[model samples]
Structures are given as structure tokens and as C-alpha cells.
Target: MSAARWQRLVDDLAAAGVESSVLDKPYTESVYGCVHHGVSRSITMLHPVSGIISISDRQWSKNPDVWVGWQVFREGRDSIVIRTWPITKKRSDVVAHVLEAFNTEDRT
Candidate 1:
């Protein structure tokens, strides 16, 4: 994705109250989504091809990447990427993990 589109995604996430930003410089990215989970203290990014959020990038830290959740890319299946797709259509998927975290926290 171009810088403009990436900016829009970051803006959208901000609007929804999710802290997010694009990587720059040596960690430059064509398309990136680093979502930080407060409870786990982890960050997961959306896959460029399948849209499935991968485990936390080791390059960023030791946080583990997610394999499967509400959205994930696997061999036979295609993933729904929130950043590249329409905002309204993918809103739920975009916030799935956040919501899950809250719900789990409440029950604990």
C-alpha cells in the first residue's frame, strides 16, 4: 500500500481508539498494521498477501505473532485484510482481537 493509504488506515484506527502507527526508516513498510494488545503486551501485524495477522514481528521485539483468530491467512484460505479493504465493511474484523481481549479480561 502507498503511504497515503497507510496514513488513512492509521487514522481510521485512531478514530476507533486503537493506538497504531506506520513503521518508517530502516523498518520502512509498503503496508503495515502494528496493533498492540495491552493485556498481552504484544503487537501483531496484518499480512500483506492474506490479511491474516501474523505473530509479532521479532524485528520489533520478542512478542509472539498470532497464527489464527477472527482473521488469519492459511494455505487454502484467503484472509480479509482490513487496511486494504473498505473501512465500514471490515470494521468488525479489524477490531476483533481488541474486543476479544476486553471480553476475556472481564471474565477473568
Candidate 2:
């Protein structure tokens, strides 16, 4: 059973000129269903310093349900998820936030 929101997210990514290769799924540990030990979707994009940036979903309970958000993917490292906030917006807004975070550098 596919979800419309997921598909919409994918569509938004593509329409935003994000490569189709990275819009749907990319090589990630959790994409293999590690978080929930069940099926999940993820999109990975190449980052300058971090190497790869992944946008995935939440899979613990459902209260703070988030459709998609950014994750930190370091090459040759296990994995480090940045954080997820309340995400529920239009395709453009979602894509903008993702791209903005991807381009933001933390100097701390």
C-alpha cells in the first residue's frame, strides 16, 4: 500500500530539479528498514562536506509523525541523523527546507 504523501514528496523532489536517482531512494542503512525493522523510504543527495544527505521518515510511534526530513550521512561512518521537526507543507516548501538545510553549514 503506497501512500499519496510519499509519492507527492517524490514528485516535489523531481519537480524541484533534484535528480531522479536521489529523489526516490539512495544507498542508506535505514533504507533497508533498520529503524522500524520494517519497510521505509529514503532519498539521498550528495553533500559537499558530509558526503551524503538523506531525507527519511519517522518510525517509532506516530504522535510526532513526520513525512520527510533531512538526515546526516557520512561516508564510511555508521550514520548520524540530524533532527526532525514538524513537517507538513507544500512540495515547494518542503523542498526548500531540505535544500536550505543541506546548504547550511554548522560552524559550531
Candidate 3:
């Protein structure tokens, strides 16, 4: 996925009031590592790994399998990538429940 696409995904998540983070910084560096890294590819390759969802910690982490649709590939770099999992209805449901906690509109 290109940086533009990645930004769009982030924007969608943000608009939906879903909280997301880079988890890795210097976006290019992180993208490079993910594409070339071993476990990183393995973890991200599978689409929407699960159907049933559960909450743990504060971050909304999900199985990549169930939502795996697109992986963000950095432009002009073969070794760079930013992965994005498709938003499933199931995932959206979960996001809605927790969105109040993150949604700007929900805040007073």
C-alpha cells in the first residue's frame, strides 16, 4: 500500500473513532523492516485471523486473518511496507463499543 493509502486508512479509522498508532516510527524504516523481516510478514500475511473478537489491554488489536485485505507497500522502496487489515463487520462492531473511549465527538 502506498503512503497515501496508509494515510487514508488511518483517516478512516480516525473518522470511525477507532484508535490506532504507528507502533513503529520513522514510517519508512518501519515499513522496510516489516517487508524484509521474518515474523513480521508471517504475522501480517494472514487475513482476518479470527471472527470472534475480544478485548485485551487498551489497544484494539485483532487477528489479521479475518480482516486481511491490503498491505501498505511504500512507494519507491521494495523493502518497505505498511500493513492494513480490512475492516470487517465484526471488527466494526467491536470498534463501535470501544469508540466512545476514543471518539472526539464522544468527549465533552
Best by lDDT: 2
Q: Model 2: runs farther than 4 Å from truth?
A: 1-4, 20-38, 59-85, 106-108
lDDT of each: 0.36, 0.53, 0.31
Which pairs of residues collide in candidate 1?
Answer: 55-65, 55-66, 56-64, 56-65
Residue-level lDDT tens digits of model 1 in 1-108: 234544555566577666666554233233248544322222244333332342121222342343222222112124332322112224355455433332331111
TM-score of 1: 0.31
TM-score of every candidate relative to the true structure = 0.31, 0.51, 0.26
**Higher-scoring candidate on TM-score, 1 or 2:** 2
Query: Across residues 1-108, which tens digit of lDDT does each residue of candidate 2 receive?
Result: 325666777787788766534343333344335543334566667665654555566543453343334333323223444543344445576677666656655332
**105 Cα displacement, candidate 1 (Å):** 7.6
Find the 10 residues in a row with the least total lDDT in model 2: 69-78
Q: Rank the candidates by lDDT, best first.
A: 2, 1, 3
Error of 2 at 24 (Å): 8.6
